[model samples]
Target: MRLLTVLYDRGAAQLIRAWRRSLHFRVVSVTLVSSTLLVVTFSWLLASQITAAQVGSRLTEAQKQLEQGRSYLEPQFRDRGDAADPGLNGFLRYATALLVPADPTAYYVLLEPTNKDFLKAVKPQSPQIEDTRAAQDAVPADLRQTIEHSRKSAYQYVRADPDGRGERPFIVVGTTVNSAMGQYSLFYLYPLDEQVDSASSVRTTVFVAGLALVLLLALLSALITHLVVGPVRIAARTAQRLSAGLLDQRMEVRGEDDLAALATSFNQMAANLQRQINRLEEMSRLQRRFTSDVSHELRTPLTTVRMAADMLFANREDFDPLAARSAELLQAELDRFEDLLTDLLEISRYDAGFAVLDTEAVDLVPIVNRVVERLRPLADRANVELRTVVPDEPVIAEVDPRRIERVLRNLVGNAVEHGEARPVVVTLADGDGAAAVTVRDHGIGLNTGEDKLVFNRFWRADPSRARQTGGTGLGLSISLEDARLHGGWLEAWGAPQLGAQFRLTVPLRAGDRLLSSPLPLVPEDAEPRLGPIPPDEPSRGVRHAS
Candidate 1:
């Protein structure tokens, strides 16, 4: 049943496509049908005319034979049988009878008017037609009228015989033979069933020939249309490829027609497009490499500066008041700058596609606990609660522990800074082949379009707000890159006043791709409340459930 349904669908689709594609098929079908109808009508008219002409010619010849017989027999009747010898008279009678048409059931009948008993002497077989009146009734009404008025004349057609042995169409001629005493009548009948058989054979041959001609015409029409439409189909296919970003799509030029010109123009356009794309790709590659190299070169000196600053900060008690304050500010600014540099370098590496995942089996519960503990001080300062929700069983995943910890640390710290004195939720869950972590905050949340921009480097919802949180503005971006490097996903969902949710899902195996998320990215407390996060609001900190 399934196979039959599929076949029916395919056939229906093909018929629709053919109707759309083949204008010539439609025209050929109409023309063939019309021509067939016209040919049949014309052939029938011609057959009727030809049959009438042949029947007329046969009747005229029969009439001439009858007149010749009369000329021979009239002299004998005029002489009252005085001139001809007995043998000659017998031979003349036999010759006259023999001259009557024979094949196809022809017959001659003569009625003597002088002797009423002459009909009795030569009476036809039982159920005898007494005269032409009875014979006229045997023909159709139309044929009977023609025969009744045709004295000494002939009429021909197809009709049933009076006795109904069979229907064999025939011709009939009648004439008046005047004798000494009264007027006698003579009639001749000639059948034409054999001529009808020949005509039928001719009609059959013509019908077969006409069918073959229609088939040949249809084939020729299909071939001609296919050749004309082939180039258009090719051009359409090539245009589709170009639309799909295959800029090198080109057509084969055959002749100097309109289609060939189109092909030539298309090829030139593709060549120009290909050259432009290559140049852009080369520039992009160089830019990413330059950024990567510059970051690497600056990091070595920055690390030395950071070490020297740390030494001075460690002994800041020996310095003067102004010098100590200066040292504190300088060290803090340096830390922020260092974070920015590190994020830029990581971004460069990702841009160059050189970031590789270093996977190892690690317990996710410990990693989450460590990040929360490290950020606990910051959360306390922000007056926000910190909590965690982790599974009792060890949730082991093949991930880069360093990157994972960094991502968690960034999410927790951001939530601490933005969570507006409300609770923060951190959830961990394991699945068949993957694990998920969700960080949610009842803080100032994102606007409708800010979910994607939240991960862009240096993107801030309110740039005018003070930098009290001390973030380098690239932390979220870096965290996103880190998750991606480990073949994981970091996605965010936020609404006005509804707080924000961020989910990080990673596969259990090193290179496995996650197909399902165990943790939901929308906070459970989001419904019924809607508002945008304010720029100047201070936030409650991260939460942990362990």
Candidate 2:
């Protein structure tokens, strides 16, 4: 039973899904249901009216025949006066030939009334009826009571064995006649076999016609809906292919109609998109080339300036205080410029898809510690405390040590820079074929939509805020690329005044997929301050940006 219920539920779900998804199916189904209801309703009304008319005609005919029989007998009783007439038993034998004659589809009953005063000619006689006892019993008592003390005729329908056979339909009419011999009670019965047969045939015809009409309506609706839905389905498929990078894909316009206009519009939209995409592609290609070329071109001059700046700094004590300050400032700016050049070149390599991984299994514990130690001075200078939460056992994963170290340095450095004189927590945990690192800082956190923009090239959350820490603005972007290279995730979560958490999740085996992170992207305390996390971008390894 449970299995049957499951199968039924599954079938219902599939039907519902199809109904929701297919316009043609829905239109045809609605037509079929509505037409079936209408056909059934009208057919029933028509069949019932026809049956009532047939029955009414039959009743009228029976009433006329009853009147004829009454007219024929009333004069006979009047002419046979009280002194001349025999008893009702003799009268029955006399009138039996004319009134109670054999009938194939009817029965007759001649019953004596309770008041014998009416039968003045002789003693009362027992009731006599033709055919089986079932026919006599077929007369409803209420119908007989209506005729007992009245001259008017009354009629009713009943079902019984009229011919010593099984029960069949019948029409029983009761009446009374007045004459000089006295009033006599009489009844006539008629079977409705012909009327029943006619009504049944009409019902069968209506059913068959209704069924055909319903089927025809369904087919017409299906064909009509298809003419509209077919082109829409083709347009949908074409849109899908266009989105999948087939920019050349376009719908074929067949005629000068609304559907053809839709196809024309779709093709025009595709053409416009393809043109814009090609222009953007060309621009991006040039931009990458310019950056790579400029970075390489500046390296020579930068090296020559570096040597001179170093010598001038070494001999700065020999000069005055102003000269030494100039030398120090020059050296610092040069270092910053060199760092920017290096970052730009690295970005160019990533853009060119030339960056390759040099992966190996390495302990992440030492790497985390190493990054913490390197950034300790910077954190201390900013009046921020650096903290680390790591397991005693070494965290191991297959990854490039150099790239991972660079990512850790970038994350730790950013945390300290933005810690706002508060503690920076760097946590490491490993589990379930994956490892994760979370760097959290209590500071003026990101605003709405900043998390997604955080990893965008050269994006700044608060550009007006003095960046004394000298970020090149490509740190997070590079880190995201590195994570992606390892088939891992670098997700960010932040809320205004609730601080921020950056989670790095990597699979234990390089090139293997990462299902989940060992740590959450939002800190426990910050969850209430945030709304729902943004949706994951599966195309990239990064999941949600909260």
Candidate 3:
């Protein structure tokens, strides 16, 4: 049943799509179907009326002839009486002879008394009715009963195949006649061959005419639909080209009609859109240039200030306590400022398409282990546990090690800062032409709708929270760019109070498309580590430094 429903739904959807795609097809199909139904219904009703009229007229004529034959035979019967002047056989022969017509349009049957054995046989008027028994049995039992018991006439329609000819419709009129020969049932059979032929001819003409009308209507519908849908189709194509950056694309206006007006309006809209897009492109270019220049200009001063701060910090012990403390704060702020400037410069280079990849074959397991070891001290200071799960075998990939290492440092540092004294799990795996690394932190997870925004430059998840670790807010954004440059993917998934997971997937061979990742974004062991950790319970999966 489900399969049938699916098939039915698919068929219906396809039909609807076809109808929507072609206006001409829709118009023609509807016209043909409706016209056919109308024509068929009219033809059927007309044929029924015509057949009824013809049969009624034939029945009336048969009744009149039957009455006339009775009028002519009654006197003869009365004159002959019970004396048996002309014997029963002679009377039957004379009666049949009088009723039988030369044209053979009608045949007569004479049924004698049931008790009489001598002339209890059917006598048909024409030789065409070869089977006398069949002719006698043609009269329906109910009709014959009515005729035998009453003086009133009764008639019915029946099928007859006289002389071995194909069956044709006939009317049998029956009535009882009391005479000297005894009580007899007389029936007159009338063949309606002419009426039948006329009806068939009418039906044939109606059917042909209906078919012709349907075809003509279909053709007319097609012509009208084409005239209307043709210009619309052209305009649709023009709109598609315009959206594809063909700013000059426009529809030809042929006449002063609705379609021509539509074309004019469409062209005007395209022109306006092209102007707006050009202006926006100019503005974007200027903004990128300005940002690049500013970043380049700041680097010299930042380097000079960094050198001075390094000198002062190297001699901080010789100065007063307050002075040394001040120098240390200045040096720390300068470092953060320099890092921000560098991130901005990197972003500008990316926008200007100046950044290039320096890729090489490298095992990712050692890189991940190194990043964890380097960040282990920071994690300890922040009271966050760092855990690593790497395959025993080296997971090799072609990548720019510097860029990947920077991304990993940013991710691990961010996790450690926000981990809320909880364990942060970092996992790596390689399979199916790709390698994946996932950093999962059980912390105050991302709020609703923050997953996508987290990758946006300078977009912070919480602006009010104090910074435990300095973040320029361009780390995830730059990481996403680096992943894309390697023809890979970087995605984040998170829910409130459920922690966040950042997954980076890269192809084993640089520039090779990565179809799937070996590891899932949501960790397999997530449920067990979701709640608060017990104070006395030793951390189970921690891998320190190594």
Mind giving the per-residue lDDT tens digits that candidate 2 earns over 171-190?
88878877675666666777
Residue by residue across 1-546, what tens digits does model 1's lDDT show? Answer: 999999999998987787677665565666667777877776677667666666676777667755664555555555443333466446445545544443335555554554422431112234444453444333344433443455444454546464445667766665655545345455555556666776676667666776676677667766766666677778788889987988778899999988788889978988888898889989988887787788788888988988989988988999999988988987998988877777778887778778877788999999998898898888888888988999999999989998899899889888878888777778899896889998989887888778878887788877876655688888888888887777777888877777788888888887776776786565546643534434442121121111
- Cα lDDT of model 3 overall? 0.81
Candidate 1 displacement at residue 362 in angstroms: 1.9
Q: Lowest-scoring 10 consecutive residues by lDDT in candidate 1?
A: 537-546
Worst 10 residues of 3 by lDDT: 537-546
Which window of ten consecutive residues has the lowest lDDT sum in model 2? 117-126
Q: What TM-score, over all chains together, does every model reach?
A: 0.61, 0.87, 0.83
- Candidate 3 to truth, TM: 0.83
Off by over 4 Å in 2: 1-10, 67-107, 114-134, 149-152, 178-184, 525-546
